[model samples]
Target: MAEMTLHTELPADMTDTRGLPGVQPEHGPWLRVDEAYAAQIARRIALLDDVPEQVLYLETASQGAAQELLHEALNIMPTLGFTVEGAQVTCPDGRKVDVSSTAPLEALGRCLQNDFVMMEKRGDEHVLTGAVLCFPASWSLAEKAGRPLSDIHIPVDEYTENVARRVQRLFDGVQVGRPLWRFNQLWYQDAELHQPRSATAPLRVGSNLPDGPFYRSERQTLLRLPLSRAVIFVVHTYVLARADVPELR
Candidate 1:
């Protein structure tokens, strides 16, 4: 069973209507270690341990990007108060994780709260080559793996043709170091975190209910790997009770 995970507040602005690629240039820190860091990291570690095949995927060719991702993460995390000692990183929650090159994505999964997905242009579109996606809102890695951005959002009704083309262009134009970000909020009765739904199956509950117990938001960011030219998709998920969510500022 998925654990009951909840955050105190939505990290980003939630007043805007949900739309395709409502992106803004990101200036501040990207990876966040929130109040739910300890619990969420524990959940992530448990998921990785219990369901490796289901939660993690690294294509043989994508190894370089994965290693670069780990290197990038290690560089950013120390600024967020994480301690790096040789090969091991001590998180703010005081948990120690090794800098495992052989399993760099797993190392990233262990330390960071955000899930990382590596996408590279294969022919005409960016494909989902690799990911350590433990907290999928309502999508599965098995189905979305190797699929392009347009195919990945097949189940999302709002992701139309124009939006897909625009998103592809955005992915193509995104530069290294300069990250573009967007946020999405949905109401859900279930806030277990690892909510992966297959493409074949229909959602048990719709995301647009007027009232729900939990408010789930994903702070999604896209950045390019300097060497591989693969776009790194990062998801920082936050779930808060309806009552805990503050009114729009």
Candidate 2:
């Protein structure tokens, strides 16, 4: 899986668990950087250029929200080591990306280390309207693109019917300013950044043992856009050698 790209160490104070607030209050800056920033961003850019169809999807109706997301990202990224001037943004890796594009989601995929997913409440449940997901853990964007929260997570045993209702409620209640975040830890045999497996296939994960060669964790943050009122799900993925995380041993 394309020469393992990983952070030398996981973030300090990192922990595991599952669920909606599985969750906590996220402070100021939504965009973040880590040791693997350059490599991960490079991987994202390559994925966008090579396989745009696999990584990016924007519904026709979600255009306005998508543009709004780009705007929001442009505003926030500057504070986190990104330089934004005019219509261009210089990422931490010294790569310049156009902040403005006909495809704003793709533009975002070019600039940020985190994979951004935009979900808007359609009727009874929120729909996965648009996303630039380069580093999916083991789920396909194609399979989960237009599906509702429950359907998107159908393969996950923890996402029960009752939990689904609670999560929907949490989504409905999450305010525009205050954002909540969470992290899930998993073990893996290898440290491939872009691991997208289709829903129909049987899963292959390395969590059966106490630990494995690598540890992968995704810090997922939930933000409500002030303009579109759509929820922005940000995933900052981290992978490290199993030996780097002392808590696991």
For all candidates in order, the CA lDDT equals 0.85, 0.83
Candidate 2 residue 63 C-alpha distance from true site, Å: 0.9
Q: Who wins the lDDT comparison?
A: 1
RMSD of 2: 1.9
Deviation in Å, model 2, residue 66 alpha carbon: 1.0
TM-score of each: 0.94, 0.93
At residue 80, what lDDT does model 2 achieve?
83
Residue pairs in candidate 2 whose N, alpha carbon or C atoms collide under 3 angstroms: none
Clashes in each model (backbone N, CA, C under 3 Å)? 0, 0
lDDT of 1: 0.85
